[model samples]
Target: MNALSIDIEVNEAHLRQQFEDCSDIVFRSFKLSDGAMLLLVYLDGLTHVQSVEDNILRPLLFNGLPQGEKPVPSLAERMKREWLPLANVQTVDSSDALVQHILRGSLGLLVNGEAAALIAQIPGFEERSIQEPKKEATLRGSKEGFVENLRTNTSLLRRRIIHEDLKMESFTIGSYTQTEVVLAYVKGLADENVLSEVRKKLGQIDMKGIIDSAYLEEWLEGSSYSIFSQIQNTERPDIVAASLLEGKVTLIANGSPFALILPITFWSGLQSADDYFERFVFVILTRAVRYAMTFISFALPAIYVALSTFHPEMVPANLMISIATARENSPFPTVIEVFIMMFIFDALQEAGVHLPNQLGPVGSIIGALVIGQAAVEAGIISTPIIIVISLTGIAAFTIPRYSATMPFRLTRYMILFITGFLGFVGFAYGIIFLLIHLVMLESFGTPFFRPVAPFDGRRIKDIFIRYPFWIKNGRNKKGGQQ
Candidate 1:
């Protein structure tokens, strides 16, 4: 227990021991006009040296206590209000608070015969400038994205919505990292019960560290063990602001560009930021295409397997001939061929994401073309199966959010396996079971498949089609519920 009380020398020594061997820690000791000792400690890279020297050091050293007068009305208070020229100053008594403040880019000032220390906020660390969003690019929305700094992200949110009802509740999670987590929502719009549930879940996180916003997403909502994303992740601030306006809660971490939006529904996966920005007709067409792509990505492989194996009549005569000719030389069954091509496609997609930005597109194209052509020529896989998997891969990209694509990828394999053995019936059963499971799931007490499963007519306007802005008003007030 490192405690600072009265004796300035002992306090300095204790702090020095606590920060032993830390090269970046700067400690300076000086004497007042009446010969009282004072100590100052701060981290070199974190605190502003110019502010410390000009605002704090010069003020105290040049205009400090009168020749024979002692500090009146508590030295800590006087120094904080009159002496320190900085804008933000806090008085802390415990050594733990001193350490926390010092580590967070604040200067710690210890006065002789005083038990408390003054914490001056003078943060001067480097941070990246806000740039365009990487993942969720928009053609018509705001271009600015959230940076890694918590304060900057909060400022971005405030700049968009100036309403006093907007509230940001902050907490320090991660015992070792002490990472900052902010839950933002608008009062009177957001549900109090959902907010309480979010707080309770966050309080239950007993981990040693939280590296990013993903950590909180996993801890808070990953308990249901579902493949589909329960919380939507967005780099665009407008998307977050829009969600807040809809009574949804968003969580922002200190060092992460992505924000976690809770009470997300399946319809969220198909909705894009551009939907609200573009004309209603265009948005409807775009959302319709995305919905079609999502369905194709999830069921194309299984549908192909089921039709070719059990229901040849479903395939047109000319297409059947072409497919039969393409599969004539292939040695593997239809299911095996689909599996082989899908595996290669998945590998290429993963490689494209992990590769360097400049080479990612080139590598994916080359890998797909070379491997796909070689497999066809060697009779390792059929051309029809390659086409099926390639279309599925392309369809997976149509979904606006990356997290929403996982369910499609995983469900594709399940449907393929089921259809391989039981033909068309298995495919139908697989989809039924999947939809049933999704209907049972909830996101922070909101239905996962909102406005669809429960069948709400008024709020379902934006589900399959993008309705006009005026018509959609007050639709989402109930959080997509009746």
Candidate 2:
């Protein structure tokens, strides 16, 4: 039967059977001063042993109930009202719920004749201390980042936005893991439609396990096939608080250090945490340079290949001569040279990422210099091709978000191949196709390329330039505050 029995022996037997072979489960049985049987169930390392000893056990075994007081109708109520010295306490009537509570690091107490159990909140498992964000570091903003503990992460957000409007709804995902996922948003600021969509998508997830925030990210995205990430992720609590103020929804999963933000725009990927903290004039200039670098990183290789192969006349005479002379000794065409170097460059980058931290940067830098010089000396690749690929790699690092840079980096090769075959026509077609795809994309019902494709003049300024906080007024139509 799912319901707890009035007999304590039956309940203890069922609980022990449910936790069969689990070495970590702790069961403490003793007799109260009134000669009544009592049982305590908790996880060994998860529940706070010191609190249980001082609060529940000491008061019950030594102090007993108050003298000359009328007896309560039920033992569970008596303990809850006058005996237990814990802050949070609740009662569960079913075996399943009692087991669930015990598994979540709570202490469960069973009385001899009662059909209910008292659960005390005493989670004390070890967790990492809060540290500065490693991925999105900012010089001026707060250095604190989210941690794996769900309550700790929520507390971080609470410390930033101290308002009653900030609401956090909880959900339990993963049948096996039973991981906790929290959805955070402001009451009046967040759009009801977007919030509904997020809830619907989350309900549709039927996964067996959710190990990290990325697992939810994959399921919550509008399109699975799109290269661009529809939801933005950050480790900083300030970013999450800012997104909530702008009427966006955020998801924080248990055992994950990153939090996911939804209904993001194309321009959001180009923006950085430092932009909001810096002066508006300086930020505008930095953003302009970043945009230019993004373009060069994506299209530079294709443009060079098309001009050298089919539109050589468009190039300057002196540069054209130099390129031709460099490729004279190379056996393969310009396209092959570019492709080979690109593959090697990508391999080196991957190796660097997987290596130990101390060796990663050193290995990538030394490997690139040695490989490039060797390939050029052997005449397998032209000097000009190496320079072009190097410039493209350097320019790619300028993009603020790593997820945003991936699409451009991957698509660059496809455009290079097409341009090599069909010349300038292929380059133009590729650019047009990319723009159309972006315009058609959506993030939880909000346009992915908003303000630019739809031509919103008021919000466009925030894309290319950052206006002073005093000058900006009201919220954008979508999920951003102007």
Candidate 3:
């Protein structure tokens, strides 16, 4: 039952029973001029019908075997070597393998009096065309983005990093889906330990299916409880090629357009795709602005709450008087007002994301302006709090990665609550704890706050400022080997 039988009827019956009730499974049988009965099995939409008809059916039915040729031991072997016009053809001995091949858009040919089956690769599935990345756009760089097709994505990487050392290892992770996942890296350049760890983690995944690269990210991350993403994902193949050159590993799944990059650092989130494409002088200024805005986003509201409520003397006399005058008519405390405004801001943002593209931006902007003005005019919220919340929202938008912004958003609320209660002391302690947590985190054994927490003076330059390519001599020292 496991292996194909020499009798065509036995093999046909076994395969039919295996694929019973499968409406899309095609079973086409025909006899050769020499009277050798052949059966072709494949999925309906997945297999290329034209290629099968022209190259397989037409050749086998009309051409037959070579005239006066000696009898070969296996009919499948002869067809694969001379009869078939296809390039990718292989033999499978077991019925299980034959079924798997057929499912994966391959044509399975079983001949009379032969135990072996020939599998022809001719996959034809609809997929999105490669377009510019929607999220990680840059002013200047390659515009091509990744599509859902696995082979097409790999080809994109190969086109960029054309070297023999660029190696890819394939894995089938999903139990039912049997989705393909590829791990790519530069040989000898990537750290052996990191590679081993990636392999071990991937093998341990017990999921029923992996629909996207994000699924692998959860399994690959060393710290599952942490909010910070250990693995970076992007739709741009250029970014993937850049990561591979730096001695990092990438995971590209079959159905997902996003590719996962590993051993990422805190700096990775702050860095943008435009950083490398633009001039270093411009990049340095942009990066500085981003870092500054990142801090403002995380601590602006907390600092305001701490000073206004608990440390009034620390604030200037004029600002304190102005804050008090603005808040005179508000019913809630400063902390409570901030919490309410923050909640509304977050809800509006979520609404924007879920809404259609035509209305998302317009609705969020109009909603925020209208809601904030209405609250302030109605004396429900103070004017100063509105300004602070608006500034904080803008600052948070400066961070390039959407994933990176989430942790800051969540922690901002926590710090705001703590600062409201304990003032400056609480704000300081919150920052210290966040830094400690970041230092403790790792991505596939690479320190999360690399070159900063450990204080690598040499590598620190790339974090605070973009170094020109001329001065760089070797691969990235953070996670890759020299």
Clashing pairs in 1: none
Q: List the residue pairs that clash in candidate 3.
A: none
Candidate 2 runs further than 4 Å off: 65-68, 82-85, 474-482
User: Tens-digit lDDT track for model 1 on 373-430?
Assistant: 9999999898889889989999999988787888889999999999999999999999
Q: Using lDDT as the measure, name the better of candidate 1 and candidate 2.
A: 2
Model 2, span 1-482: residue lDDT tens: 39998888999999999999999999998987887888999998999999889878898889774442676777667776764566588889999999988888999998888898888889889999999988788878999999999999999999999999999999999998889999999999999999998898888899999999999999998798999999999999999999999899999999999999988998888999999999999998999999999999989999999999999999999999999999999999888888999899889989998999999999999999999999999999999999999999999998877778888988899888888899999999899889999999998888899999888997887889898765566556464766
Worst 10 residues of 2 by lDDT: 470-479
Estimated TM-score for each candidate: 0.95, 0.95, 0.95
For residues 329-391, write the lDDT of model 3, one tens digit per residue. Answer: 999999999999999999998999999999999999999999999999999999999999999
Count clashing residue pairs in model 2.
0
What value does the lDDT take at residue 285 in candidate 1?
82
Model 2 score (lDDT): 0.90
In model 2, pairs of residues that clash are none
Off by over 4 Å in 1: 65-71, 82-85, 474-482
